[model samples]
Target: MDRIILHCDLNAFYASVECLYRPDVAHLPVAVGGDEQMRHGIVLAKNEKAKAFGIATGEPLWKAREKCPGLVILPPHSRRYLHFSQLARNIYQRYTNRIEPFGIDEAWLDITEKGMDMAAGRHVADDIRGAVQRELGVTVSVGVSFNKVFAKLGSDFKKPNGTTVIARPDVSRLVWPLPGERLLFVGRSAKNVLHKVGLFTIRDIAHASPRVLKGCLGKAGENLWRYANGLDDSPVAMVDETDPIKGLGNSITTARNLTRQEEIRFVFAHLAQSVSKRLRKQGLVGSTLQIYVRFSDLSHLEHQGQLPAPTQLEDDLTREAWRLFQGVRVQKPIRALGIRLTQLQSVEEAAQLSLLWNEKKRQQTAQLEQCLDQIHRRFGPESVRKAPGLDENLVSLVRSTGVASLPGRPHAF
Candidate 1:
């Protein structure tokens, strides 16, 4: 029997939650934004009304204001979002213990064990949507399907509040005509590449030669082909199964566009420092390091490369991230810079060593980082400097964006 899966996504989550608490702005077009004074003032989330004004999430607040002059911008309230997220999770627990959270506002539920057939799954999706609406005062869009990938695609089929069911018979009719990007794991960058080859829709992706797709998209192209053909059979995680940390990253939006190499390095150093510390704390190391750059124009690009070896040392991370950034041809001043460590392995695993590099130097550096972590733990995070203190403006900028991770960036599962 085909397993039943449902992807539940909260509608305009942050903005909806804000409206619930701030009734004064409930009827107006509202958006949840960051601190303008801090220069992180981007539309983090917006309600349906704001959507009508062409106010998009991740666009600048000034631009959003230009689009909708009467737009009400409210600061984010994370605590409330979390409280409501947990409450919604509680509702899911009543249905099944096999719940896997895609993000705070999205989750996947495996209801096959409940003996639910495809028809029953749609009923449950409606029940979940209605229950969340009545109890939490927020709407949910749900996609019910046989597997995780299609379930996520189905949930995204409708918005604000709707339930979409995609069963085997519906694949050719409903799923194929959608854009290739809608098939999942296809970002803007990847979409352009596929488009270049005339693979515009999910049907095109499915019908295209696998070799041709892989030649264009590499491993991701192959995955897209499988997803387009309804070949995704990945299981939803059980509730008791803790999600493993797949990657670690940190980023900062500067108060000013960073043009100087020295200033950019300072930002990279701080971000890498935070990420490496977190990796060490979690007892993990990564072999791949990725750097993300958002230019002053809001245009962005990301590049990544394999490291010399798996590492959790700040110096190693900073050096590798800087190496990757240097290869990018700078067309514009940087508005934001980020570092990410992926292809991670637990520190408990034996690290590969090479005589090609000085292993002893790396050991010394790791020891030094551990000592610094001890000092930072006892005194404070500011007790030690990572990269021989650069500009004070950059120093405070990093401090202001303390514990910076990619805000609202979801992992493509």
Candidate 2:
């Protein structure tokens, strides 16, 4: 039997989720993003109504506003979106256990066994779409194919709640004439090179000499050569608990370059809260904490230090992050700030315990952290946020960025 993969993508996910609560905004030129004050930021998501006005994701929000002044700008509700995402995943589990969430808005499911025929696969996809629409009142697009890349492309064939199938024989007919940029893994720079080589379409690359393509792209060139020919064999592997996280960090590009110590401290506290929440969620502790500072000139400086112990405790992580920040010289306007925790170990499995502190103090600190985590989980992150994080400006900025919530819904671009 030919292997089958189904790529499911939620349409205009953030905007769709927003529409659930505010149906009045449906079919309007709505966008979800940060405040207009952040001049360089772009539309995070847009409804079909906004797309009709030539607005696109990642285009500056100011430009989008200009393109359609009446565009409804809604602050991204990360928590609510996440809640919807969980509902989508739960529905997916009913179909197959071989599921891999791509991000907040997309996932790949191996239903080759469950879906014995193309028609069955389509039925499964339709069922998923109906489930989302019924349970969450959002629409989804599904792409059914024999591999990950084609499955993803199939999902994009239609929009705002649609489905497309890519059988093996139709691969060339469906994909080859598409622009080189449409191929997976081809970024802006690669597209330029391909363009210059007169390889404007996937068909052009498919017919090009392997030696020439490899010479041009190195290892990536080889992969592209295979992709152009519809020869992808990558499997949809379920995300494993033990898989080392790609990265553990927090970063914020401020609305304006900040110089005040209080403002910087406030940002630091926010970052700390975010980082600690991630650590607890992953059930991991870190041994090294790194701080990154990007000056106005774009030059960057980094400071790192070994923590006394591998800790998931917010207070300990924050103290170390602040210590590193203090050591870095701030000679120029700061454009961005970041904090990272590395050298990870499962917190539940770690054998090492603090010995320097007296038993009572250690117990008290642990109890305090446990209480805080409970409050955060039960009410919300803000329900138990540190006082420093409550600064009005800081709260507005964080809420706008939508980073406070856990990864829930699969969002589509």
Clashing pairs in 1: none
Model 2 Cα shift for residue 10 (angstroms): 0.5
| Per-residue C-alpha lDDT of model 1 across residues 305-392, encoded as one tens digit per residue | 9987788888888899899988999988888988888878876573533321466887788788889999999999877775557457
| Candidate 1 structure lDDT | 0.86
- Reference-based lDDT, each prediction: 0.86, 0.78
Minimum summed lDDT over a 10-residue window in model 1 is located at 348-357
Count residue pairs with overlapping backbones in model 2: 7
- Per-residue alpha-carbon lDDT of model 2 for 1-413, expressed as tens digits? 77778899999999989987888878689998866676335588999999999998867687898999999988787788778888888898898877888878899998888438777788899899999889888899999988887888999999978989888888779988799888887877678888887889989999998787887888888888888887888877764434456347777767777677676766667777778877877877788887777676556777889988677677777788788888877888786677777778886556455422344765587678778879988997778666766677766544554333322222111
Question: Candidate 2: what lDDT?
Answer: 0.78
